[model samples]
Structure formats: structure tokens, C-alpha cells
Target: MPIAGPWIQLAVKPTAFDSDDRGTWLIFDGLLQAAGAALLIAGIATSGGDEEPALSILPSAGPHHAGLSLAGRF
Candidate 1:
């Protein structure tokens, strides 16, 4: 099938860039993946040892007045 060629190419020589558009896309995809991985690592590293429960605040607005509600698992 027509789709087989591209799949074969990707598998045979993984680093090969078949065309300029594909090359650019590969580069951008790699950058985004790296960024996501870095953020994940940073988040894990920065989380303190304290096992304190997480907290969150939600704000609601209606036709009359607005109010803030706090939620947590202390």
C-alpha cells in the first residue's frame, strides 16, 4: 500500500529526513517533546517532601454577586 513506503523509511533509517517539510516537522516535534519532558522532570524535582494535602480555590459569578469557594484535602 502507499502508506507502507513511509513506514518502511521511518523504520529502516530512523534519523533520515525524506523531505524538507518532514525534516522541519521532526525538529519541531523533537523540541516539543523535549520541553514537555523537561517540565515533567522539573515538577517532580521541585515538589517538596512535605506530604501536605493540595488546595484549590474556585470563583463563581452570577447575575447578582460573586463568591470564592475553597476546597482542599487537609
Candidate 2:
């Protein structure tokens, strides 16, 4: 894939539409993939390979919901 593959997909997303004229799902796919790849690259670039990234996971709850609260520093 090209370095700008995701961006290219997003650029051409408009023309990928069908006759229904709905917004292209490729835009979301491209954006999400791009964001994930960026984050991965950032993490790899910032890590020294010896120091582990800081992280904390705590139980979280609300009136009608409960989930894990994740916090971290990379």
C-alpha cells in the first residue's frame, strides 16, 4: 500500500457511492485505519524499548453502566 493509501481512499470515497447517494463507509474505514496506524507509529517512535509505558485500569460505574476506566502514558 502507498504511504497515503488511506488518504487516497478517503479522497475517492465520494465517487464510490452507489445510486442511493448515501455517505461512503470507506471514509470512516480509511479515517479509522489512518488514526490507528498513526497511533501505532507514534507509540513505537516514542518508546525507548526499555521503559514500559505507564498504565492503570480501574473499575468504573455509573447510574446504569459499569466498565473499566483505562489510563495510560506512552
How much does candidate 2 score in TM-score? 0.41
Instruction: Give the clash count for model 2.
Output: 0
The residue ranges of model 1 lying beyond 4 angstroms of the native Cα positions read 1-20, 52-74
Worst 10 residues of 1 by lDDT: 1-10
For candidate 2, the lDDT comes to 0.72
* Candidate number of the best lDDT: 2
Q: The CA-based lDDT of model 1 is what?
A: 0.64
lDDT of each: 0.64, 0.72
